[model samples]
Target: MIESAYIHIPFCSHICNYCDFAKVLYQKKWIFNYLDALKKEIQLNYQNELLKTIYIGGGTPTALDLEEFKYLLEIISTLNKQKEYEYTIECNVESLTEEKVKSMKQYGVNRISIGVETFHKHHLKIMNRHHTKEQVVEAILLLKKYGFQNINIDFIYALPNETIEEVVSDLCNFLKLDIPHISTYSLMIEPNTPFYLNHIKTIEEELDFSMYEKICRTLKKNGYEHYEISNFAQPGYESKHNLAYWNNAFYYGFGLGASGYIPEIRYTNTRNLTKYCNGEFCFNQEKIDFKTKMENEMILGLRKLEGVNLIQFKQKYGKEMDSIFPIRQLQKEGKLQVHNRYLRIPEEQLYLSNEILMQFIDT
Candidate 1:
């Protein structure tokens, strides 16, 4: 069952030097045409069932003008569901406005994810991000004023030239907010990004790993649950929309560069904006075999802090997690711990989880 929907809006006001997400510079005419095509696509795939969640992420959804934003929201409001579902909209800090937030609230959006990557102006400029810290504060306050209660602030840590003190200071800035959710990630120098081209020196491996642990401890001390690899939420405020993805549930993905998984197939659309905009859709689809599915179950399930449920895996796939897996091996090596029915990597091994999880795959 397609219980979740992920819609991509591939336009941004300006490409941040560090961003690698599929996006093109904002053009008024391009947006109008692209939006029309997007709506047409949505109508064609519109399922008249109550979805469990809907996530509207983008290069920067807030970059659109009030009218364009409204047009997009009005189109998505057509979702027919049995109950109120989680509807999340990602917004850029500088572009968010009170009116835009109000439009989202009226259109049934229950959560607003603001990209406040960091709280330092110098770090912002260094990253080539255009938003000011004060602007993020304004956007957050605006969302609250518009009667939205569930707000999630996205933070990035461990950037080049970042020190432990600086990271903790950034956390302090985020802590001042009343928001219930925050997602943090170590800034990596992705292969094709400008940061990589400029040879931006990332933090030391050990230091970066230490920072990750510190964040978990601090956030937990501040009364948040470290639920997933990159997510922390106050009790009962975890992102349900992302949870569906983490759970490997079927989701409908729309717009160019988006990916969808239904039944045995997983596919991603073309990344070429021109080709996608020209109505020539490209999909890299693959049928997942049993071996692949089991591998995914092991790797993705381990991403959750609570790890995989042995009984649940057996019920879903008709095999014990430890039977065809090396659970005892990982435990013997001290990389993983088996508690009750869940097998999870130790908190200290989280940064090296990719290395640990790879052991479950068939080489």
Candidate 2:
């Protein structure tokens, strides 16, 4: 059963240079129509089953004005919530005010993830991010004041001209916030983004590795565990919604440009706003076969630091992981190791995980 749902709000107040998510500028009239369509889509897709987690992400979910946010929250509140429900909403530091934070609290939101890509002014300007460092601090303080302790802050490193010192500075500032969760990312220049349009090149691989190492070292020195490749969290605070994806569990994805996996089918909604507002929800879908499903399970499972549970994997797929894949060969190559019945990438070899995971592909 799908115990989680992800809702997308495809509107941003300002377009960032590096963002390629399906989003448009926020307009009141468009938002109204979009919400109307979103309600229809949810009503049709949701089975009124109890959901354990609900995540609202987007260009910036908090970019919606107060009234629009309330309406969206009201619609979401109708979902059958579980006793251990974890409802999260993404917020941009610039647009998330005290009132907005309070409104989320009033609507049963227990978690908030803020996009504070970097604390450095130069990097912020290059990325076209408008949130000031002061705003981020104030937002966190406000969330804390209102009893919202389950907070997450995002940081990006290895920008166009970022240096080791700069990345460390960003990490230091991030640590100072005392937030429970931190998600760090090394910059990737994806196609169709402003950075790609401007012909931006990625930083050197060595530098990127250095930044990743620093993040791992610093966060580990503190109380945070590197649970996922890009996520660090204090114990008991890992993102349940995100883990549902990494575990290859089923979930419902609603609103424009969202994707979901339901049993054998994986689907993505249309990115075209006009078509989505007209009630055409899905743009692409694939009926997954057994082999494909196992491949997804391996790829997604390896993302977690604890790796795939061998017994659980056998129970779910009814096949031994060693029989289906060359696990013994990978162990000899020093890329992967099975420890305590969990097949995981060695801590020192994590940076090269992509190369190691490729060997498991049946093709």
Please list the C-alpha lDDT of all candidates, in the order they appear.
0.83, 0.92
Error of 2 at 308 (Å): 0.3
Q: Model 1, range 1-363, lDDT digits (tens) per residue?
A: 788888888889877767888787888887777777677777777676578899889888878999998988877777664485889999997788778877887788989898888878788888888888788878888888888879898888888888888889988888898789999978877878888898888888889888898899889999999989889999989999888877777887888788887788888878887777777654688999988888888888888888887888899899877788888878998989977888888877787889998898983
Q: Which ten residues in a row are the worst by lDDT in model 1? A: 75-84
State which candidate has the highest TM-score.
2
TM-score attained by model 1: 0.96
Which ranges of candidate 1 are over 4 A from the true structure? none
128-233: candidate 2 lDDT, tens digit per residue: 9998999999989989999999999888899998999998888889889999999988888989999999999999999899889989999999999999999999
Q: How many clashing pairs in candidate 1? A: 1
